[model samples]
Target: MIRSIIKNQECFSIVQGLPEPGQDHNLVWLEVHTPTVEEGTILQQRFGIETAKKNSNVVEDGQFLYMRSRLLALDDNGAPHFGGVTFALGEQLVAIICDDANFQSFDIALQRLRRKPANGQSPKAIMRSLLQIANDRADELVDQIAEELEKRAEDISEISDGYNANGMELGVPDLIETMRALNAKEELIALCIETQLSLARTVRYLSSEIDSTNEADLQGLVNELAFDVAGVKEHAYFEHQKVQYLQKSVTNILNIKQNQIVKVFTIITAVFLPPTLVGTFYGMNFAVMPELSWEHGFVYSMGLTLSAAVLPLIYIKRKGWLR
Candidate 1:
């Protein structure tokens, strides 16, 4: 579907189809969502907006600035998904194309534009507004992921203390879930980093090509955006490292638990070994075996076997291994 928003005579209005080509207007924004074959052709023929290739960097084709953006959206389960958004910026027009259900970024930019008077709105201004909105959303999502990782880090630390925040003893399943969450967050952070880097590139190119004259206000806006994007990227990288550390912590905890189990079995075997040897010696049928014919032979063998079992327990306790 294709929708057009036109700023004419200091008023913003939505038009049904693309604004009449070459029609005088202060500025126009065309949003094409999941455009069909014919719609794509019309867009290209009328506005020279064509599909960008696999590249994510902004490029200038003498007539317009073309770039592709990765739009991030969360699903019902709060998982992040990326979609493609193609932007074509011209002298007085900005076209956004995406194969998604909605153009949320455009909607938000439009709402903000409407809140203020439409005085002196230019194509560069509109493009900046859209990019700022996208950058803000990305930052917000990154912040949320950071907060979750912090919480998860605390939870894992508690588990290492032998219990969780709820005072319940930690189990393998709990660690598994924590690992899963960390992995998911890691993937999201990686995606955020990629998106931020892409935006950074776009911002630089947009500033250089579109803001060549360096209008004071616009230059400041671009600089602020670049700064914001860089900060988000750095934060994302930091959280990514945290995720890695948490993963290792979980693995180490699991390994410790397994070692404890093996230690227990080893101690049990040591405690029973002497008794097993004693029982075998007593059961031998050789007539020359000492104490074989004594009246108290059974009693002696029982006492000796019980003593053998208790000795290992005492030794283990003395070494503090039983704790």
Candidate 2:
């Protein structure tokens, strides 16, 4: 859908489709979501907007592309790719171009600000407002990721302490899977931080190219956006550290548990070795073996087997290996 928001005569109004060429001078913003070639043509013919190829957000053809920050989405084969809003920032015109569904918050913000006086009435200000919404969305994603990470940390702690979510002892496989899932959350938070940083940089670049007079009124919004981006970047970094720690702790716990199992198996094998040797030695008796010929030879052989097993038990117990 193609949506345009224009600041005309000190008022912010939402228009359903493309504006006619030369009809309005204060048309500050034009948004296209999943537009086809035909829709792209409308903007190109009317406003000299460039139709970018390959759904790419990278700046091309003398048009400055501002990629909307988005969560990471892996494709069918699990490769990370961008799937969010992208706007081309240009002189006297800001195009909200997106092939992503998650870019709707900007529209909601525009609605909230529509009735408010467009006192600034500048394209740069409109651009800043849209960017602010994107940042707000980023903040919300960060908070959500943080909450999920907190819960996952608690779960990992519980498993390390030998308890499950239901207070039962958790198995090794479950713990490993839980820690692995956290990798995806960290990935998501990282994407959000990148989004925040990208938005800040794009806005700065746009601000820089404009004449000082055109950008004078947008300085405050731009500064606030930079601060927000910085704060989010710091928070994302801290959260990323927490995820790493959780992964390490979970791995250590898995290794310890595995080592404990190995120790038990090693002790079992040690204790059984002597008994098996005794049984094998008797099994190899010759036809003229005296002990096999004796009447009480079976009892003697049984006693020897018991003694062989008991000696290793005594030895291992004295060395404090039982526990």
The parts of candidate 1 lying over 4 Å away from their true place are: 20-27, 52-56, 74-79, 117-120, 212-214, 287-293
**Residues 187-278, candidate 2, lDDT per residue (tens digit)?**
87677667766777766765565566646656766777778867877887888888888888888888988988998999888878998999
Query: For candidate 1, lDDT tens digit of each residue in 194-296?
Result: 8888888777877885554657677777788889889888988888888899899999997887788899999999999999999898778886976778999
TM-scores vs. true structure, each candidate: 0.89, 0.81
Which pairs, if any, clash in model 2? none
The ten-residue window of minimal lDDT in model 2 covers 71-80
Give Cα distance to truth, residue 205, candidate 2, Å.
1.1
Per-residue lDDT for 186 in model 1? 84
Q: Candidate 2, after superposition: displacement of residue 139 in Å?
A: 1.5
